[model samples]
Target: MTKIKTHLSLAVAISGLAATPAMAQDTWEGMDTNSVRGEVQQRYDAALAATQDPAYISANDPRYIWASEAKAQCGIALGYLKSRTRDEVSLSKCRMAYDRMMDVPRPRPVIAATPPPAPVCNRELPGLIFFEFDSATPGPDAAEIVSYVTENAGPCNWSSFQVVGHTDRSGSNAYNLELSQRRADAVANLMTSRGIPQSALDTTASGEESPRVPTADGVRELQNRRVEILVNN
Candidate 1:
């Protein structure tokens, strides 16, 4: 239960910021009044299991860090839910943390055969890596996600990659565009350092134009602050 910085959730103090009904609903996914605690508890159980999972523990999987973080955040939310007054903000943070872990699977190391055939997989491999608001530098999960993308690229025989960056509508249009591009470059640069050719990457910045979860012009929706790595063979 180490205080791992849960990026977007804690990047800004939002005690005074009350989320609108629409925004909260979208952000919470299915954490409604009826089953909020039940749903969160389910993810908490899964996160707890991940911490001790040999697939992660034995091989030092990077995702284990996220799982551990999710467990802590979710645990906090569960505690708050038990109190007389529920903290909506904390619950939102917990849900977002759990969402990050939802798609990621346990690490499975591949052992190459002596004379294996050309690497290929009949499937698509895409990645969405979030960032702290207003910052171009990658966050804690950057390296881990980059590694995941690169590992899958080999099997997909990737011909090209789309590295598009986005930002929550918190700043001016002009400034946001620049920030988004910088974020794209940050992720693209990681790929280049990992040996993914620059020419093969098509980078673009959506700024506040394309948000995962739309909000007001000045809203700081954590889910909108992300870079999507789209892969194609």
Candidate 2:
């Protein structure tokens, strides 16, 4: 029966999860005057401490049954010690119970580090540059908007840019087409002057077509005569 109990105790301790004893009881340091009592007391304290380890605390399947067996063995060992009986078998069993619990691996905890926030660009994009009637210039007001885009371009991740020019329905279709190209060129030049890369600029003209305000032919609409800065970041 004792051999069967020992095998069962070992099986539970092995099946449950035993590890390098997490935190041993301090009583291991203080030994009793009698050799048998001191040994039993030491092994008892150690076996109990093994069950309290972090790895076994949450997963207590093996700890409870094995700890009960260890306690019973320790109790028998203690009884033999009190009677001054030289029962080497009981003492050996107590040692085996304690040693069985000292063998499993524990999983350590891991901590994660927090990452920093990314940079953000608050400037408005797809900048509009309106031209005066019959002229290609974007007017002085375009300077502030261009400056904003130029300075914030890097932060805003602006890679490619398109300067699309448009004309109001006033001149002949051929004349308006030529005028729109000139207007697009003028805005592209202005952007390049403001430090925008020339290689990144693309110009397109839509003359007297796709008007913003939708005006009839020969009408001069202020909204239609403009170039737009389209950012493709």
Candidate 3:
């Protein structure tokens, strides 16, 4: 009889993270752990189907085992983050598990099968809108960009729209953070008003930490002060 190996359990990986009891249970509170686990099980099955190798689409294939485990953990980690339980330790463990799984050698294909075309998802709009110093108002070009997003997002049935704001390094860190957040909010508000649902939008401020170009402390860079829009389906 052939000995079958099972993928490492997510609980075992979580235990290795050395999570504090409070941190681990924070998001699980007020929720039925059994029910959530069942939901995750369904997602795991779907992911396995999505990642299964065409040549060996069976439960015994080590490739399917590896892909499903990595995907399940990654999905769980994202769920925790989305639930407002963001922790570096949990995220690091998930990433490591995925990397280690992908590092393994996959079986050579005995039969050639043309893989299905990848799904069309995620779009980065052309031409970012540069912002004036300390201003949240959209200029003429910025308005055009915003219009494109508004017209396309709902029709595309996008799952989420990310508005990331950045700023030049001319101001204090505190000031830049606030300015960047305001700019992101301005863009998000415009999109929501134009028909995009508020629930589908996320706003983040990068401040001076993520400049388009490296510059001195007091330098004003035009490209750095901008908002990036990403649509993910």
Best by lDDT: 1
Which has the better lDDT: candidate 1, or candidate 2? 1
Model 1 lDDT tens row, 1-233: 12223322332222133446643554545455547677778987887777555554333223555565566556655655555234565566556556666656655556754344333222332556677667888765568667757765867677689899999999999999889899999999999999899998989999999986669899876667788888755
Q: Which pairs clash in the backbone of model 3?
A: none
Give me the candidate number with maximum TM-score: 1
How close is each model in CA RMSD to the real structure? 12.0, 35.8, 17.0
| Of candidates 3 and 2, the better by TM-score | 2
Residue 49 error, candidate 3, Å: 45
Q: In terms of TM-score, how similar is model 2 to the real structure?
A: 0.47
lDDT score of model 1? 0.66
TM-score of 3: 0.46
Give the TM-scores of the predictions, in the order they appear.
0.55, 0.47, 0.46
Error of 1 at 155 (Å): 1.0
Question: What is the C-alpha lDDT profile of model 3 across 48-78, one tens digit per residue?
Answer: 4445344323334345444444454545444
| Candidate 1 wrongly placed segments (more than 4 Å) | 1-125
Question: Please, what is the whole-model Cα lDDT of each candidate in the order they appear?
Answer: 0.66, 0.64, 0.59
